[model samples]
Target: MIQLKTREEIELMYESAQLVSKTLGILAKEVRPGVTTLYLDKIAEEYIRDHGAVPGFLGLYDFPNTLCMSPNEQVVHGIPNHKPLKDGDIISIDCGALKNGFYGDQAFTFAVGTIDPEIDKMMRITRQSLYAGIKKCKVGNRIGDISFAIQLICENAGYGVVRELVGHGLGKEMHEDPQVPNYGRKGSGPKIEEGLVIAIEPMVNLGTYKVKFHNDGWTVTTRDNQPSCHFEHDVAVVNGEPKLLSTYKYINEALGITSNEEDEFLYNFMHD
Candidate 1:
């Protein structure tokens, strides 16, 4: 069953979501060549705890770290390690936080320093695909509508949409109902409605969509050993329109990036 959130519950979730967003923004400044993923994970845990929330990923499903750090060809769930990041490499950081009985989940693929132009293009397209899916999250639209919107954009750019993994509804529990796939028919799946909140993410690959699950039971990498990008946002339907519970504004500000890609999804409360 899809557990819809109440208006009060959604408000609480917004706080949780923004905490994750702020955490990502903090990490954005620290992500650079010579920094170890394990080091990044350490600070993230401390920050989340210092802010009065628990690290949602750590010890959840026995996962050891606060962040899932995937670099280069790795897709997601790559455990943080001691190896230092290098220039020209990209790393995807997926984070979660639990606050006030709610959970927030979001991810971003970051350039370690200067990266390959083709890889940068793939990252931009993947992030754009995330917005495309968010644009379809209005009341009465089917979950597949969001999926189709995401799929069309990436595939048209000659990128591969990951098939095995998916986005999902989120609230008190980390993973909720209504699995939101990245590839589906335009009108298929569950109808979106008010109170529906989901983490809409797109995992796009530079080569084939096929992925290899590592024996460690966590790491996932592109089968062809090519780079992949992942971007995510937390969105909720309010008064029949889609509102973003998560924002990249903090991250953009930290990086000195000025873009209004999320302006259309901004509801009034976000500004205050």
Candidate 2:
């Protein structure tokens, strides 16, 4: 069953989403060549708790971390460890928060330091695909509209869109209805509607779309051992349009980036 959130509920979820955004911003400043992902995980857990929201990923599925830190060829769900990040490596940080009976989930792939130009291009295309998907999340479109938009962008650029892992609807629970896949037909799947909130993530690999799940039961990596990029946003169908509850503004600000990529998706209520 699909759960449609009320405006008030969406607002509450917005608060949770912004906290995750802020948490990501805090970690952005520390994602240098020598920093460990576990260290960043601890910082996120503390910051989320200090802000009065629960760390949404901790113990949710017997998973033992506050963030999913996947680096280089790792696709997603990589566990945090003491291994220090190195220059030219990129890490995808996925985070969530639960506040006021709602949940917010978001992810971003960050460059550890100076990275390969090809890898940087892949990240840029993947992130752009995320917004392309978001643009299709409107009143009359089906879920496939969003999926197709993302797939077209990545595949045309000669990248692989991850097949097995998909984005999901989010509310009180981390995973809800309406599975949002990266690849699908143009006019298929569930119809997009008002009050429908989802986490639209595009996990693109530089090589084959096939992924290998690890024995640890959490880590996922590209089958061809090529770098992958993941970008996500929590979006809600509001007033017949898709409005973003999560923002990359904080992360961009922290990294000294000045892009208005998210301006089109800003929720109107937030400005009031």
lDDT of 1 by residue, 184-231 (tens): 999899999989999999999999999999999999999999999999
Candidate 2 C-alpha error for residue 35, in Å: 0.4
For the record, the alpha-carbon RMSD of candidate 1 to the native fold, in angstroms, is: 1.2
CA RMSD (A), model 2: 0.9
List where candidate 1 sits over 4 angstroms from the true fold: 270-272
Q: Which clashing pairs does model 1 show?
A: none
Deviation in angstroms for 220 in model 1?
Answer: 0.3
Worst 10 residues of 1 by lDDT: 263-272
TM-score of each: 0.98, 0.99
